[model samples]
Target: MKPLFMLLLTYLLCWQVSLGQQNSYTGNGQVTFSAGAPLDLIKGTSTAITGSINQVTGKVYFEIPVKSFQFANSLMEERFNNKYMKTDRHPKATFIGEVTSFSQNSKEVTAHGILSIHGVSKRRSIKGTLVKEGGKFILKSGFVVSTKDHHIESPKLTGGFMAEHINVNLHLQLIPENVTPQVATVYPAKKGLK
Candidate 1:
């Protein structure tokens, strides 16, 4: 008779390989803002930030598609996709940044990286707060940006409605990607998103 232990080990190895998947974590959060006037002029989010965090090196890799940005109103949607952002042509924005320092001895880390949008890339340094509860991680950060700087020309339709500088925020939570598929990240105020 075949060795019983060997038979069991073979069965387990086959089962594990049959359920093959990737090792990944998703992060999510929201960007609450006053927009310098609080006219519902902020983008909100619930994005599944797919990436890995290396504890030894402290590197964070995250990605979001340009088309993923959504708006609360129809006008907002058109204004974003049809006008300023031009998400259709330039499809995605990726963040490949590093958490150089953390305060929790490992809790809150400072994430600095390049944020590319509207065909222009800018180096941004953001303060990110993180909490590890279980098989997940939560990240929240926001920064101020001027549309003019990125050459985002506000369309004529606005009756002087658009603000010169918009407050951009990112609140995100991430989970192991192998557990979820086609995970969607939505940003309501992403008029200038991706």
Candidate 2:
């Protein structure tokens, strides 16, 4: 009985240590962006974020390809891709920076990163919460953006129908041992994307 008890205690101690000090810097992430006008406006989300987070230094960075955006209406999707976003011209919008502050044992962090859209990059300061659980990193970061700033002009048909200052929301779930996330071409790919 003594030997059994000692083994169990040692196992528990090892597990706890592994959860803490064994923190890793390599983790996957995601990005979600949505824009709505008045009525009949569409929203969307994407997961093409790729980057790393250093647990010790509290630095994190990620990237999401511009080609992963999906829309509710098929025609709208094409218009957004071929006209508004011009994904062919701008392939990616990346975020890179360090987490300046966080609470101890809380697992929630406030990270600051830069946002690059179109062929232009801007200094975007973002504040969000993070959790390291199930051997993965989950982040929810959101910000507002001006369509004109990124050169996102309304399509010819949708012109005068959309808003200039659009609100974007991002919810990223980065799972471990997972490969790159592809365009979610499933049913209603555009509903509530961002």
Candidate 3:
């Protein structure tokens, strides 16, 4: 499953190359999730994230390795990986989509795409803030994920300690792509370069 996410990312990069689009940015991001229950709260965070966005095309992609998420309690982490997420089998969660109604000057943007997790794929539209500062693009969003939708079964042994809905948060900071395609460029042709 991790290989599949890698393949998808590679394919997107190749697609960018094929389109001669260099006006892009790719970098490491962060993902955090929190869930509330009657007994206690569950929280985890992961920094092993990679994502990219094409400035000219409004395309976006993000990938998260399941095992990268860290929990405060080792036992919870183990149970999360072994019983809930099954990270050994399905190792990644990914999203690929296009930004709609986006602009560098706009404060809010939306990305509509498919979210694949736990071997289940669903169409999800995420709305977030888009901030451009010092030549970097920052995107942040918060959303909810239903465990049942992704086939992530909570342990009945918890005595209903887990919530059915998981709150997810994402943060990405990206800089413009420095490498440009040799044949076709993403940005418009400069004067006398045509």
Candidate 4:
């Protein structure tokens, strides 16, 4: 009887450790943004997205460097970093929030948190899908960002070449932090951003 009890205790301890490891994940991903006006469309893609998730606490955080985004036109890229986004002053955009609703049986998830861009922070609720496959979590989400909300000024001189709202997309695959994946990188937290 004592031997059986000891075996059960050992099993429970191992299970708890495994559960803790599975609860946290860190990874890199891709982000895309598109702004469409009546006459022109501006789009950019960046693969420098880094994020982490704590499943047990429902905490999620993501960061992307402003200068990392790439555009089809060099002029657009330069204007975005220097004139619009002011990458020299506001170097990164980040989202820090909690998963308000999540279910393992379902793929739908909602995260409520603060999104900071161009040194402006706003409360936002982003809806996305989470899928668990082969011990990794794949998160996909789409949302629109308002230029006014982030204090981004439109180029009036360009005759409405930029839209008021930009469409953003995210595709991320997060793996357990303990495991060393091919592209596992997490950005360090910045001061005053939390």
Instruction: Give lDDT tens digits, candidate 3, residues 106-184.
Output: 6889999999999999999989987887878888999999999999985543564557788999998987776643432
Query: Comparing candidate 1 with candidate 4, which one achieves the higher TM-score?
Result: 4
- How would the candidate models be sorted by lDDT, starting from the highest? 4, 3, 2, 1
- Which structure is stronger by lDDT: 1 or 3? 3
Question: Where does candidate 3 clash, by residue pair?
Answer: none
What are the per-residue Cα lDDT tens digits for candidate 4 across 1-194? 54456666666766667667789999999999988764577788999999999988989999999999999899999999999999999999999999989876778999999999999999999999999889899999999999999999865535645478989999999998783223323344565664
Evaluate all candidate structures by whole-model CA lDDT and list the values in order.
0.60, 0.65, 0.84, 0.88
TM-score of every model versus the real structure: 0.65, 0.66, 0.77, 0.80
Candidate 3 error regions (>4 Å): 1-22, 103-106, 155-162, 180-194
Candidate 4 local Cα displacement, residue 85, angstroms: 0.1
Off by over 4 Å in 2: 1-30, 105-108, 154-162, 175-194
Which 10-residue window of candidate 4 scores lowest in summed lDDT? 179-188
Candidate 1 lDDT, tens digit per residue, 3-54? 4555666666655643443234545444432233444454534243344555
Best by lDDT: 4
Q: What's the lDDT of the predicted structure labeled candidate 2?
A: 0.65
Q: Considering every candidate listed, which one attains the maximal TM-score?
A: 4
